[model samples]
Target: MTARVDSAPADSQAEAFKRLYPDQYYRRFLSQNTRPDGRSLTQTRPASVVLGVITSADSSALIKIGNTTVIAGVKLEVLMPKDPPDQGCLQVNVELTTLCSPEMRDNRPTEVPSFLTQQVDAAVRGSSAWQPQALCIQAGRAAWAVYLDLYVLCADGVLLDACVLAAMAALNALRLAPVDVTDAGNVVAAGNDAMTDGTSHPQQPYALSKQGTPLTLTCAVIDDRLIADPSSEEESLAATVVSTTVDGQGHVMGLQHAGGGVELSTAHLQQCITAAQDRHTDLFRVLSSAQPPDH
Candidate 1:
């Protein structure tokens, strides 16, 4: 659950209530008829996605859902793990920079990163996007682990939605160099931990596993109005709900509710799903059309 702002406050106390306990007000909206943005129960906000924004990364993308913007980078590395030799792990991290929002500060670790990263890790692990066998070396002695890093360059609303979309696009644009393994099973790559040893190794590049159909889509609520993407101001005013759904695939990768007043009904939930299905064309188009940076 992310945050939200309730529209059509009934009174001054209700307005204050929307502030003091937005989650509760958000719930009231869901139970009532209208949403905060004056949208139908099934409407989603506007969204746009850009690919290969970072020239230096192996793969990168920027996605803006409403006013929320997220940047994602994916880097590939070979390593030896103490456990699960046959399975390559996916690691994700999030950094909410100060430029994203005034609420985020230079003080302690921001809550957005911890929450968004957890969702990303779960989504990648649960989806059939990556195969551990593809990352295997000699049936378990070594493997390759992919790290996906996300940075909140800006945050208007629905950080999870933008981050997840950017992450998928970045992964699709990723290209890993060749891996060399001798008969002795000694694997090698001509690079340091940063992959900048500057020595080119002779090996053929292999494609990664096929990405799962229909990536997850996130929808937040600003009261009864179930906005496909909410901006930061909208988030600040209501109780927010983030539902991660893989349309057509119909898998609920993740679901989180944040804020104070959002009350969702079963009917509203169904409406959100319908909205996500409608957005799939745009989402998949952005994911598949994303181009990788030239190395």
Candidate 2:
């Protein structure tokens, strides 16, 4: 009983030390096969997704993984591409503001936003989540351009994963509004008397192709150990980071690797794919639940 009472003070002192030296604290936790946040190396924090957060946009989704939060919104515009007027365009942008993290408090640009935009764009377009040709109003005339915008509300860790998820969910929840294509190659709202010269098209909701939904999961290589769904703190100390995008059919869509000095082995890459597939199962469950019944 006496020894236990004395240990309480020692534990309190250790806690204080951890707060004072976070890097060392995290190392100590990793040495014991755990993280400072009480998660194992391969485990991720609580995640959730909600659709239709922004009423102004055609479709939107808000996703959260632990303290990190991201929201995605889509807007449709009429684009007349020179080469493939039959195929619509996909514009992806990622915005980071002071509201996301202290690093952005100065209002300077960082590489993170562009990197995130590339990852999300590749995952959605490369995976063919929705066929661009389907957006065509008339051959060689006009097509719908999808504007996918992602905003980071918080950046605790695994930001790319959250952003990709939000983008995919928002695109998945998107429903194309009925429009009329005028002879002058202009698109206007359907059933509007102002655009009487245009031909009205039947309302068709946007839907994902037969291809399964895409999900991107991020992993960090820390001290030569692979950890999936790393928190922002862990990502900071990582030697390398890899992101794997997979579909519900367990198909690999895209892979992104950042940072170097430590080369990842083939086995590690395979593990990342496996981890993404398993995580995809869980993510899809959340996405399916968030989808509207009409879709």
Candidate 3:
């Protein structure tokens, strides 16, 4: 026979209990229709975007989604691809260091979400955030390759969402000096635009043709409930995670299972898409308001 206590758990006792029984502690909160972070099942944390944070990079932006922070920097290089000689290329690399999370502190090393880069890459390319034709300096001769590097400075969770926001904001904030091919077969920027290394001066900026910037939402299902923008703690307890990437126009750019092999129902998938679309409205507003050093 079990006896029930009338009094609720003390805050300090609850905290200690959470430390000892993490899974049960978290599930206790979830059973009450909320998360440990105090967010509703469908709620997401606040987000912010800051542009032109890195002076050395061609373009850069820092984005924060709750505690998760990601900084994206881009450098434009000239290249001629074998298949698509005239089109420009976009290379994305995402790195999560030890500073971002305690799990990465040991020498053993921790693997980040393997699909985060793929999700952001698919969204960026599919949406034409950078136009292939615009990247070409001369037809089939020379083209621009955008190297986008994203660093996760904080690891609260919803990593893909933060990374995608950083990448999109950085791409749109790009300001490059006009460049042309010289008689010596060298590409040079217009007057006073290039440094000794032939890279565009950060002061002289030209806007790149960007469209359909992406906003990604990651939802975790636990106890048959969908939770949006789960924190790292919540992610650990999830049965599965589904990421939905959408544009400002509510068009779905990409969708995938980011974690766990557990299958989700059609309704759950639709719910994620809807959440992403709603997130786009707020995030796009923030992106639009970003102020770069130059136009």
Best by TM-score: 2
**Tens digit per residue, CA lDDT, model 2, 257-279:** 88987899999999999999999
**Order of the predicted models by TM-score, top scorer first:** 2, 3, 1
Q: Give the clashing residue pairs of candidate 3, or none.
A: 175-206, 176-206
Off by over 4 Å in 2: 1-12, 192-201, 208-210, 293-295
Top candidate on lDDT is 2
lDDT of candidate 3 over 1-295, digit per residue (tens)? 8998776669978988988999899888988998888889998898988888888899899999999999999998987655676677889888886689888777564456446677778778888555776676665666778899999999988898898899889889876556766656577765553444354434444677766777888898888889999999888888998888898788888887856678799999898999999988988888999888763
> Which tens-of-lDDT digit does each residue in 70-119 have in candidate 1?
88888877677557656776789988987887776666665768888888
In order of appearance, the predictions have TM-scores of 0.74, 0.88, 0.87
Candidate 2 TM-score, true structure as reference: 0.88
lDDT of 3: 0.82
Q: If the candidates were sorted by their lDDT against the true structure, best first, what order would they fall in?
A: 2, 3, 1
State which candidate, 2 or 3, has the greater TM-score.
2
